[model samples]
Target: MLQMAGIAVAGSCLSPTYASKSRLLVSIPAQLHREFTPPLPAFISLNQRRREVLPSKSLQTALIRCFDTNKAASAESEENAKPNKVYFARDAIVDAAARIAPAVANLYARKGGQEEEGEMGSGTVIHEDGYILTCSHLFFNKMDVTYAADEEIIVCTQDKEIGHVVDAYVDLDIAIIKIDSPSSPLSTAKVGSSSKLRPGDWAVAMGSPLSLQHTVTLGIISCVHRKSYELRREGMAMEFLQTDCAINPGNSGGPLCNVDGELVGVNVETMKAHKASGVSFAVPVDLISAIIKPFQSCQMPVQPYFGWVMRNVRKENLEALKQYYPTFPNALEGVFVQKVIKGSPADRAGIQAGDVVVDFDLQQIRNIKEMMDVMVKRSGTPVDVIVERLMLGKNRLVHLTITFEEKDVAAPRPRL
Candidate 1:
């Protein structure tokens, strides 16, 4: 063995307990001849004169192995040190916001002969002829009053266009304001299918949260068809698109867009932020047609009656369902019909309360909202409903065409 500069050149490997972990010189090679040169310390010369010596074949072989190992390690370190590239949809956000921002109208209301302009909510232009969609709560304080000709209603557009209410839902928190004779052409956002939304899809929320004009925030769709009662404890029985996007007081009635610069939902409410964080909900874009369709014929905006109260089958509810219906299938997915109204479409069609709805009108039913979306437009139309019912202690599939009833009911209100 040879020793120099506190290094041990031994024939055998040293224990890791006593080895210097910071440096690998002692671990790399076993032998060092007079020609051996350290990377550092300049290999201090004896008497200030350098001596020439030839290295043995074994020493050269060991040096070669050490060089190969170091080369491989350096390559690995370089790979690890390389920075990663992060991709963002900056152009998508900018374009989508441009299309949606023009339709957004900041609202201010004067109630009960008050002269001051009170902050209301946000609105989106659904029609090119100046039809703006907004929340119904924006027009009323304590008593719900119709926007009369004598009352003062202000709708300030992104391009400084003034508008007023043309149509409003009596029950639901949805209304339409119209911009009369605008200075320029209105920019209407393209409406996308909310039925296509999936969990973790990119979601962009543009609204005046806290009255901050045209504020935009980006997030993912945390969930789809989230029930209103789950978040608010007690409120309207409605489905919403739950997201992590921040929604504040004045963000109501604003647009919730997708990555394709299309409107997917309407920003309605923020979750209990005092208890939860990054939780908010939006009304699905399908509801916009639900609020507008009935009024097209100069009739009252009545909710399309499905005559069945159902809940999405989740893991937590599976156990409860098993206790009630012992023969319920363990692999069943979709909606669990909780109640069937007597003499209604579901009840007359032989759909029981415990039956699990798997498909509606040939389309697979994944959630409660999917079924609602189908029934909302087909109020009087007969559609096939496929359900799984337990009969004779076995699961059986039942198919029936049920015609929905059209009844005068208030539109669904936003709960949370």
Candidate 2:
């Protein structure tokens, strides 16, 4: 089941920048309703975004002066006076869209010998050897039988091709599909650095939203990290790149490109309704870099699922905590547990908010990324964690044993 990104309410709200009533609706795939029993709608809010300020008055006046014409001027002289700002970026976007469109696949799934009519979601070609990356949820069905070796799944790009699931990592909602012996080498996407993305950077989302093939939407990055509020209910401590890119149902698993047409993220979630311009989320490209080699090689890497999100302890946050609790840990190097999912491995082990994870299985965890690496390296094994718990105006050292589960959507257990 899909969950909302943030708090959502049913009503219409006027957007200051967009001269339209922006309504909020869920972007859950329509195939879920047609192919199987329909689930309840995921409520997500599309909050009004910050507006971009116009250029300075001096610059505008100068442009106006350049374009201003005398009564004696001819048409040829008027054309020469127009501003000639070199904009190669527009051509780059168009070229990139054309180059990448053939690699984006429209997925189709079957259950009990019945084929779904429409596309499930979009996918990206990560390798010229026919390796595709998509969301894991797209492979799931409400059928009793597993997919057969042949004719169970098909991928539609420039031509329809049989696709087989190579590997999947449910924690990041990433799935790898291989086209069964393609005719020729496919066009691969140019991956960009998500670590370098800023809040106001230009973003372009390309996908088959609502089955509209090759649709592209433009927006700016609203936030680098938008944590899911319904993490406990969803069983995944999810983080996403929040943007007002107008993503719809079929947009999931498509490429979220930067201004230079490089893939910065994989489009995953969105907020949309009857009359809403939605906010979309993407899995950062940096996260993919860690395991792309294994994924391309058709190997399932161990993605640790602890059911909690953490962040590096900044000096400002440490100062605030110290002021509130006088005995807060003086040691500044550790990851702070921000949220722990209910009934998860971390929750069962008694992890809580305001707890600083000092050590993981005897290894010091300096940041959240380091913690993730530790989890991946020690998959399916019980590990001891040393956390400094704050209670009664003092910091107490606590040791907890937690076994992380490998992220698998096919398993009956909880997945990330």
**Backbone collisions counted per model:** 0, 2
Give the runs in model 1 whose Cα sits over 4 Å from its true position.
Answer: 1-86, 111-115, 140-150, 158-162, 233-236, 291-416
**Residue-wise lDDT of candidate 2 within 1-416, one digit each (tens)?**
42222222212223433323443434324434444664344322232242222223313422332433223344565455556554345476677666667667877775556777776788888776567878755653211112222334567776777666554444456666767667787777777788899998888888887778889888889898777663221323556788898888888888888887788888887764654455678888777664354333323333333555454565545665556544456658687664455546687789885678899988887655566576555555678999988677667889999865443523332222
lDDT of 2 at 21: 43
TM-score of 2: 0.50
Each model's lDDT: 0.62, 0.64
Question: Per-residue lDDT tens digits of candidate 1, residues 110-190?
Answer: 445563344467887665555677776665321212222223455677465555444343234555665546676566667
Best by TM-score: 2
The TM-score, computed over Cα atoms with residue i paired to residue i, of candidate 1 is 0.50
* Model 1 / residue 287 / CA error / Å: 3.8
What's each prediction's TM-score? 0.50, 0.50
